[model samples]
Target: MARPVWSGALTFGLVTLPVQMFTATESHTVHFHQLQRGTSDRVRNKRVNERTGDEVPLDEIVKGFDAGDEYVVVEPGELEDIAPGRSKALEITGFVDLEQVEPIFFDKTYYLGPKGKEYAKVYALMEKAMAHTGKAGIATFVMRNHQYLVAVKAEAGLLTLHTLHWADEIRDPRKEIGDLPAEAAVTDRELKMAEQLVETLSIDWKPEEFHDTFQEQVAKLIEAKRTGETVEKAEPPAASTNVVDLMEALRASVDRAKSPKDRRGQKAGGAAKTAARSTARSKRPSKASSFDSLTKAELYERATEAGIPGRSSMSREDLIEALRGARGRRRADAS
Candidate 1:
């Protein structure tokens, strides 16, 4: 069995429990090696001294900090002497409501449990208290010679540790993001129609429902190439691709959502699509004009079906104008 990464005491006031920490999550990413194009030679990197451009000898290196132009090198015993016992003690300073910590602050989590029989009662007490109060203990501990801000929480009838970020680690998102329009300018009728459209499209959050289509395609292409199949090189994805129109995009999304994968059961694909669309104007609709061909009356009816805001008060012209304009804007601005 693998040895625990950390062994410590979970102490708050008079109570203390000896515990061991083990990793909670495992990763399954495929790893790759840098190989020569024509030969099977593998590539590797070495630490080189910047000034001399020579490989640095690891044994000779010492931990150091530069203050202005001067350097302060420390011995192996120095760090442990200056700050110790943090490794052997997960000192809980305080407890706060779990909701106070946002998802962003957490880095990684690990499991913590009693190290031996003597600590079982104390371990159980702390875990039960955290679970009952729905609070997490704000604590600090050392692991692999590095200090971490840790949160002790109850998980599956046991205590779990989550490493947290230091104050300077998190960046404020407002720095990169501009303010967005919180309220729509559309009438109640248009809003109601949009709501109905949303209802028709809504689904539970099943992560497996979606897959990275590009990645899956790439994997398929690679498999074919490996099996000696002749294949054309795929085009690279464009950076900042051109946008699709709003009404068309939304309509496409709705159609895809409602259409049965087994084509036999589809009811709306026949005459209704023709009534909403004008196929007679041109044998082939230039992509941009198809959205425009949908009459103001069709747009309003669709919006009404979608449950857009103030549907009863808005005229047919108003509803069509609003839906088309909003959908177009949405398509253009979509990332």
Candidate 2:
């Protein structure tokens, strides 16, 4: 059971729905300790006064904001009183179509669920309205000490609050992405080829298909070091750099993605070939497996029928081998 981090009522006209905020993400990074290079002595950070260059006691420490090199000491009680969310309420102004929102503005997400039994109907109504219309609520909310531009979105039958970035926070890529050479001209053939490549690579959203492979590999490498094992690291894939010939690169990528490994578990009889496909296990054996590929379930049944005790407890690999032997014996008896 998750405890609510915050409980608040959203105000849209006269409609008010009691909602609670819950953290959307959980960090799973293994905790590590800093230690001396030679000895295993743990190292610790010390609190020191930067202006005086002296170590300060825990009780003596105070926070101060530098105003033009002059320090303005901030009192804890005063800051808490001025904190935006002292009231702990979210006031929604109105909703807008999701298409109007920029992807760059999205920052952090929090799950919002009904606070009490009385709020359930209103919450559901709001969720359904947004989901049906493909719209998101533009809300103003404060959490901790910061006022946020928030978007209330319906996801998986519940309302989710995504804190958005202010316009000033986004850097204008146009600053670096300047004009190309005046003489640079794209032919109609080139444009057509580019469009075709884009169409081939276009995909539907499937969040589970994407992961932080670099992070996973780093974790594996750390585990290897911990277990006193050495493993060869795979070389990084080649990157495309010639923007002038981007269509050429995309053409190559599209061709490569059509290969056996890339086409696995995908239905190729439609448009949007790159759209993520769910790899559902087939009840019938795939052609790639032994004797027209037997499923683990079928193999286990075969093993049991052959008087292999505890076949149900056997692993998939064991079942496959056992079932193969059983089938071989049956074939031998027929001869």
Candidate 3:
């Protein structure tokens, strides 16, 4: 079990329950340590005195706030003495409909669990009540020397505390983005086609379906370097079409959505010729493996089934090579 980062009392009205806070989410990004470019020596950062150009010890360090011509130095104990004592309790000020809380205000989330068996009953009662009403409790509590605006909501019989940004923190996009586009006209036919394309590609929301592709590529690059393998750079994507080709681009996009990798020969009079070529290729049957004819999407599916690592970010050619290696290994295992 994961350790709780905080312990406190959850208070509202006459109810008080001992609760512990555990982080609800964690990042999976690969991190690297700083090292010298040509050597194995580790690179480190140090605190130094700017005036004397000397390294400073941790005990000698003091935080200061810039005040015009000079800085006001403050001691750690002085700050702690003034820190709010409300950190020991999460006190709910009021309840509001969950829909009122926009996603932009939400920051870090933590799961609030009952601290002891005796508090479990009250904890569950509050959780079920909030879930049933579809409401969240608005609260303010200090944690780690900072007071946070939070929304306490119930998720699967557990209370979740989401830190929220202050109202002033959310900037007005209209002012920052400047020059909003004038309302443009869209044709009925184009609208229908766009909606149809969206419907064709829509699927049930599954968080697991998405992943960090760039991070996976970075990991693959590091592993390749460690194993002395040659890493091929991917070709850059083509620039987007100009405004004149909007209709044609939309049509092509719809076709690509309808058939993920089969939009190459989709012109008005090309179907017959495409069919003839396919028929001839089917009859000729080259000595090479059928995998060569598969599209990148198809190759990725096969690589996934074969349990090839780093398949998520592999190019079409790299996927083909990995699949070929997997086939060889399977044959050796069978032999």
TM-score of each: 0.64, 0.68, 0.78
TM-score of 2: 0.68
Pick the lDDT winner: 3
Weakest ten-residue segment in model 2 by summed lDDT: 273-282
* Shift of residue 325 alpha carbon in model 2, Å: 20
Model 2 ranges off by over 4 Å? 51-61, 176-184, 237-251, 259-335
Candidate 3 segments whose C-alpha is farther than 4 A from its true place: 178-180, 259-335
- Ranked by lDDT from best down, the candidates are 3, 2, 1
CA lDDT scores, all candidates in order: 0.70, 0.71, 0.79
Error of 3 at 105 (Å): 1.3
How high is the lDDT of residue 215 in model 2? 58
Model 1, 1-335: lDDT tens per residue? 55777887888888878888889977544356899899889999988888999998988777888987999998756666655574688888999999999999999999997898877888888888889999999988766667899899998999999999998889876675678445646656445655756987565565543434445455556788889886445435335522344444555445533433422355555685655534532443343554446654445445644445554344444466667766777789995
Better of 2 and 3 by lDDT: 3
The digit string of per-residue lDDT tens for model 2 on 1-335 reads 79987788877788888888999998766567999999999999988788988999987766789898799997756666876656476877788889899899998899998888888899999899889999898877666556789999999999999999998989877675687345677778677877766675455665654455455666777988999997546435456658776765655455433434445754564454333222222343543467425655556444533555445445555566766777778889999
Q: Identify the superior model by lDDT, candidate 1 or candidate 2.
A: 2
Range of the 10 consecutive residues with the lowest summed lDDT in candidate 1 = 255-264
